[model samples]
Target: MKTQRGDIPRRLDTPDPAIRFYLFHGADEASSRSHATRLLKAFGAAKDAMEGGAIKSDPAKLADEANALSMFGGAKAIWIEPAADEIVAGVEALLEAPGAEHPTIAIAGALRKTSKLLKATEASPHALAHISYAPEGREYENIIEQLCREHGLAPAPGVVSRIAGMTANNRELARQEVEKYALYLGSGESDPVPLEDDVVDRLGAGTGDVAFFGLGDRAMVGDIAAVQEGVDAMSANGSEAITILRAMQRRIVMLAPMQARVAAGEPASAVISSMGRALFWKDKPVVTEMLMRWSAPRLARLGERITDLERRMMFTQLPAKSAIGEELLAVARIAQSARRR
Candidate 1:
């Protein structure tokens, strides 16, 4: 069965022992592994259960390990870490003749949503697939609350917003920061403590700045030089290509609908003014400029291309930075072309 990220907690609360195979795949590696660990624990398996196996995309060996008797001869939990597309065949074999003594959870890296491996796992009667993405909006809030409940911390009102501001688009980092905050509060204490705004600021210091800092706004406005500079700065600061690309993708999603409205005969100034009220104060200027620069059709095309770029970054071994750079430059070229016309 396909599972939503938010549903994972509820599902774990009442896990199905009969579901012996779990496919945890997504760009969010931290969230994926975290979920896998929870699934293993649900099956009464230790965190170190994968240490005993010869795993990693070897389907035949995976099948053998699944069917093979454990040293203790009880329910076994075998993990396949960083499972690639090659493991699909092995997973297929296991499903055909599932003698799985324990849950065989496969933790995969960023996979295309239409991946054959992912599809196979989802289609299997005995397997559950959970796709993890970066948490946002209400989902992000829910994660904060959930983490607080798990670690016995009470969140003061608006603490979630403060935590969200500090974390900024990274689910794993947010989770870790929450845990750290909880630890700081509970140190040498016998009971949970209420997490206040001051405590949050103190514990979450130095986490407010995101690596991809203004790149998204630059990309939206077709400021290619600024975007390139931002990318370089972010790379120097230890940001990943996927992280930068995701930031750009978010801008595209936000701009596409507004551009579409403009194309359908709304005035750009009116649209910008309306959207500005809804947009975060800091982002309104660039978004307004981009709305003026891009037409409806062009923004739609950009949206499609951005989606494709995201897929390539996730599934292919192609140079993500190069691909993203080329695409952003192309967007800048479009702006240049518009100016000439």
Candidate 2:
């Protein structure tokens, strides 16, 4: 019968003994794959993966695989990707096989509402079907939080939003990020420490998708040598100076609120924790140092400066590499001199 997305996880984790066939299809293939993965993990049995095309070509093969026993004596679960109406006859054959013991999980793309496979799966008492749709707003946040819990992730505020935004709300990607947190924290299906924003900032950001990470971070923290090194490297690669400024601009925007909190008498750690979780263990000393050094007024001024630079750099025909590097160097030097005094 048709199933709800929220209930599908329960069904996969502890499958109903009466049901042997599982069908998942929808516009969100990522969600479908995630469900299929959950079922496989729950089963922990050997897989007997068969393509939907192969089943469509030989309808009897589906039944043959399902009814057959493994020589090694471990249960064999069938896997079908791109399950479609063309496999209807094969699925029907599997349904008809009285001796079918192995569970079959099928992943399909968006299926037409009138698709015969959809109807057959829904109508069969021995079979189950679920449709996945892209989650919107709070729904996406809720899903991310659930995944985090399963993986022993105790997310701080904004952690879920960052993951959801970074993964573009894809369940599989979100699951991966949460799993990473669990791994890093050594949390194995157990209570985990609050997941912090600094940890995600250092770990997440779309898997190397953000090329601007280092440039801005180095410039803002008054790492004069590092800033110059980063700029020189970018210039060597012919990377636009605007890209560097934009990355720094983002960092400044994120830091502005924390700076305000710090200015209001809260410790940097407290401010950071309020935003999310703390930095990972190994990076604590260095991050704490940076936190102490980041002045509210200076960070605010840098934000303004970087914003204007980014806007002006957009249409400039001049080579901006030297100009941008010099600007960052000035910010770093000022920070350095202020600290020295």
lDDT for each candidate structure: 0.68, 0.74
Best by lDDT: 2
Residue 338, model 1: lDDT of 69
For model 1, what is the C-alpha lDDT against the true structure?
0.68
User: What TM-score does candidate 1 reach?
Assistant: 0.63
lDDT of 2 by residue, 137-197 (tens): 5687898888887877889866776666566546787788888877777775656677887
Clashing pairs in 1: 59-90
What residue runs in model 1 are displaced by over 4 Å at the alpha carbon? Answer: 1-7, 48-58, 67-76, 110-114, 156-158, 187-192, 205-230, 236-341
- Backbone clash pairs for candidate 2 read 196-277, 197-277
The count of backbone overlaps in candidate 1 is 1
lDDT per residue for candidate 1 within 1-341, as digits (tens), equals 78876688877666775676788877777778777767666667643344213443355776677767777766667777867676777778777774676568778877777788889888877788988876655676788788788788877766775566445556777778888987787732346678876786566646334545345556666677886775565443233555555555556666778878877878766777785324544456667688787776776787788668767766666676667667767777677566421
